[model samples]
Target: MRRFLDKLYLVSGALAAIFTVGVLVAVTMSIVTRQLGVHIGGLNAYAGYSMAAAGFLALAHTFKSGEHIRVTLILSSLPAKGRMRLDLCALVIACIIAGNLCWFSFKLVLDSYAYNDISTSDDATPLWIPQISMAVGTLIFFIAILDETIRRYKGIPETIQSEEAHYE
Candidate 1:
C-alpha cells in the first residue's frame, strides 16, 4: 500500500511536469502561428488550462516531499517530544483543510459534468475535463496528509527535517 501510494504521487508529479511542458509548447505554438499570420482560436485559454493542471497535479507530490513552504522556526525551537506533538497537530489541521478542498473540488467536477458546462472560449472546451484533474489532485493531496497524520499517530518519525542544515 505504501509503495502504491508513493507511485501515485510520482505519477501525479510526472503528469504535472507534462502539463507544464504543454503550457510552454502551447505558448510557443501560439507565437509561431502569430508570426506566420495563422489565427489559432483559444490558444491562450488552452495555455491557461495547462497551467492550472500543472499546478494542481503537483500538490500532493510536493507536500509529500516536504517541498511545500512551511514555517519551521517554531518547530525547530521545540524539544523532540514537543516538536512531534506540534507536527501531528499541524498535520491534523492540514488533513481537515485538504479534505474540505477535495470534497468541494469533486463536487465542482460533478456539477460541471451534470450541467454540461463548457468554457466560453472559442474552443468551447468542456469544463469537466480540467475539473477532473483538479479534483484528483486534491483527493491525492488529502490522502497524503491523512497518511502522514496516521504515521505520526503511530509514533513513526516524519521525514520532514526542522534543522536549518537540512535545507541544503
Candidate 2:
C-alpha cells in the first residue's frame, strides 16, 4: 500500500510539472504570436486547461507530503488521544469527500469517452485527458488520507518512522 501510494505521489508530481511547463510555454508562445501578428492558437484557454491539470492533479501528492494546510493550533495543544481522535474524524470526512469527487470524475471521464468529447477551442484537446488526471489524483489523495488515518490509529510518531517502516 505504501509503495502504491508513493508511486501515486511521484506520478502526480510529474504530471503537475508537465502541466506547469505546458502553461509557461503556451503563454510565452501566445504572447510572441500576438506580438508578431500570427495565428498561433488560443493561449488563454490552453493555459487555463494546463493550470487546472497541475492544480488538481497535485492535490493528492501534496496531501501525502503533509503539505496541506490545517488548523493545527488546537490539534497541537490536545493530548495524544484527543489529537488522534480528531485526526481520525478529519480523515473520515476527507475520505468521504474525495470518494465522491472520484465517483463524479469517473462518470465524467466515461461520459467524455462515450461521446468522444473534445474542447470547443481551436486546439480541440480531448477532454478525457484532464478528467483522468483529476479523477486519479483525487482517488490517490483519498488513499493517502486513508493511509494517514490508519497511521494515526497506529500512533505514528513521525514521518520518518513511516518511511522506515515503508521500506522494511
Best by lDDT: 1
Looking at model 2, report the run of 10 residues with the lowest lDDT sum: 157-166
In model 2, pairs of residues that clash are none
- Candidates in order have lDDT scores of 0.91, 0.80
Q: What is the TM-score of candidate 2? A: 0.85
List model 2 lDDT by residue over 31-77, tens digit each.
Answer: 89988999865677789888888988888777776667677778778
Superposed Cα deviation of residue 75, candidate 1 (Å): 0.6
Cα-based TM-score, every candidate: 0.95, 0.85
After best superposition, candidate 2 residue 113: deviation in angstroms?
Answer: 2.2
lDDT of 1 at 27: 100
